[model samples]
Target: MRIGLLTEGGYPYATGESALWCDRLVRGLAPHTFDVYALTGDAGQEPAGRLPLPPHVRAVRTAAPGDAEGGGPGGRSDRCGYGRRERGRFEAAFADLAYGVCAGDVDTGAGPHADPAERFAAGLYALAELARAHGGLPAALRSETAVRVLESACRASGARRTLAAATLPDQLAVVEQWERLLRPLSLDWYDASDGLGRVDLCHAASAGAAALPGLVAKRFFGTPLLVTEHGSRLRAHYLATAGAPFTTPVRALLAAFHGRLAGEAYRRADLLTPGNAHTRRWQERCGADPDRLRTVHPGMDAERFAETGEHEDSGDPATLAWIGRVEPAKDLVALLHAFAAIRRRQPDVRLRIIAAPVRDADAAGYLALCRSLAAQLFPAEAAGAHAAGESPVSFEELGSPEAPTLEDAYAAGAVVVLSSVAEGFPVGLVEAMFCARATVSTDVGAVVEVVGGTGLVVPPRNPTALADACLALLRDPGRRHRLGAAARARALELFTVEQNLAAYRGLYLELLSHAPVRHRAAPGVPFAHPAESHVPGSWADRPAAPATSAPVKATATTVAAAPGDPDA
Candidate 1:
């Protein structure tokens, strides 16, 4: 079956979230054809070039948010130039959407009207239809008339108080952001013959902008949308905008718009696969159907750490390793403080801070500060007869001789430590598990879930708790060995790349099997010809497989339970 895989800032790109996982999935499921629709975040992400795509990818279409600058789909010269009638249509639709956003109230309770949600959806589809007819929405959405419509809606009697306070600049910013976020509506990827309409399933790699196209495909062509969110995009938006320069009203309005979008996506999606329970809970809070939600953990290749897993005693008995990008969120400062406490308790203990490449200026500054703090905490000793030149707290990169690779980094310590104040799936912790190394991680994001009784989890930002956990592991080699062995067993059983591929493949087949078969009927033939069979096999000699026009029915048993269930 052909799949329309949608992504935002990921996949095919050399750097982006989920690039590796998406590439692995596409390669693993070589039997299916994929049409990639990528929404790049910026120009720089593609400079290093994309990862080599597998042959099964039929085509890849990329669009950046900056594309909205040209006014619309075909550019400034090809603007839709809406007529009086189209202008009226745009006014009504845009007003409804803006009102729905400013209202800031969607009935998410049981059996509620969901009027705000429905209005937002209705206005959204109307704009999409207009864009499809006119070749783009930029010209209309960018007009002064659009700004007036938004202002009127925000000033309406029932609007949120924050929105009523929006100034002209705030209005302009909100409208510009909406234009960018809604750019997918102007895309020509919905045609039945050549675009998303032709695919059997629309798999969105994440929510928000990337999932918008999938929502459109499902709405227009009845294509089943499978939304897999590794991180809750809605939550991310709220966090990201917390410090934005925009006015409170503008931020509130934008948040409402994104909230409505998430609700609609969740409502329309046939299946919601969150990478972990943390994301699943966020989806559920946004009104995702409990029955439709399934937790599919991100997969990692264990073979890369197989050698380390087999030889658990190779690492230094006193070293504690922290492997990941050095960012503020990683709380390396707290790690440093905790390491100081560990040193006080055991002066011979060493800490290896294996830094991944920093991605931004902020992270670079943070790394420099961490280095300075390390110098203050463990100043280099003089080169005496038995003195080592290296600082007790060493910061090393991936290719360094001490930590040649990720597997080597995990193998360089008896206890792996994660001190992040925020995380998604705790990929590093899972990698350490794959290496069969005991871990001391902070209780953040999915660390507790991923650790699953194998590692000691401490509260984030608490140096004492972190140091105590590290000391507990350091003081007991037998316990570390037991936990390491158990961790490897759990990692192999639950988090391997093969398991992820199989889960998705099952989900795809399950969704397709239950979906209505789209086929043209022959004249005067009532079940006389077989256009397509729902079941797999050569059915040329058999009668047409029974077709049901009923909505797809999913039983409680349809989705497998989370992996490693005791009963199983």
Candidate 2:
């Protein structure tokens, strides 16, 4: 089946979260054709170049967030150029949607035109079509014409009083926000010639920005969309403070719009795949049908750390290793306090906080704070400690020559520790398990779920609890060995790329079976195209043949299992 693989700043790009997983999925499922529609965060990431494309990926198209319409904050006031009829329709549609957001009522009156949710969807499509027909909506929405239309809608009954009373600055800000929010509508990706309109299904790698294009594609064409959220996009955006600088009213309004869009996407999708039960719960709360949701954990590459478990820990096994990006969210402060408690119990115990250098500003600041806390925790220096190279707690970067690589870092200790106060998948925990290291993780994000019964899970922000869990593994060598072995086994079975590929291979077929195809070869192509172009036109009409004698490498089906027909 042809799949429209939608992503934002990832998969195809060397940088970007979830790039590795997306690459694995594409390469693993070579039988299904993938057309990639990637939205880049900036022009700098473009220089990183693209990842090696597998045979499954038929094509890739990219655009950037920085290229969104209205290059300047002041350019939105020009609207004299739009014709009267088109301007009126555009303004009216936008105003109706905006009113729905301002009033916080999806069902304005339950009618097609008045229903707020329907109005928003219809208006979003109208704006997209308008942009397609014209050059784009950058200048149009920024225009005074758009503002006047919004003003009229706000004054109409059933609209919120605050919207009607919005100051000039508020009006301008709202218009600018709308332009940014609707930027996906202006992208040139909704035509039949492009792979988007021809794909059997659109599989969005994430929700929010990455999924925006999928929504647009569905609206433009009758394409069925499948949105998969590993980390909740809405939650992540809220946590990351994407547009926090805006006024509360503006933020709330935009939030409502995103919520509505998410709801609509969930409502229309044939299926929703969330990476964990935590994320799935969020989807359900946001109106996703319980029946349509599936939990699929993101696969991890486990082969690299296989050598670390070759020997059991015996040499000065007092080291506690913490591996992950050094961010405030990881709660290094609490970790330091926990380490101090461990030191009080076992004076010889050592703690190593291995963090990657901060690439982002927030993380840089957080790392500095963690370093300061470590200094404060281990303030007293022994007279001969400098020569002996001994410190109770140490902050080290991942690539330091002393440890060299991540595998070496993990092998430094028998126990891996995760002190994150906010987490999604706990990649660090999985990496530790791959190295056959027992883990003690704070209860956050998917930590408990990922660890399952293999490791000790403690409550977040409790230094005593965290310290005790670490001590349990530290004191009992036998327990550590057993837990480490079990953890490794679990990760190898469920989290490895091989298992992930197998799950997705089955899901691909399952989705194809239920989601009718929308594409077909031209008149001159090999087989008869199904009326529903997404279906295999010839496969539908053919009688079942005896098993095939040759293996189909793409499907991983063995030849010996089937006998007779060439194309079974």
Best by TM-score: 1
Cα displacement (angstroms), candidate 1, residue 497, comes to 0.6
lDDT per residue for candidate 2 within 181-249, as digits (tens), equals 677777777776554766667889876767777777777676777888888887876775564786655
**Each model's TM-score, in the order given?**
0.88, 0.87
Least accurate 10 contiguous residues by lDDT in model 1: 559-568
Point to the candidate with the largest lDDT: 1
lDDT of each: 0.84, 0.75
lDDT of 1 at 3: 91
TM-score of 2: 0.87
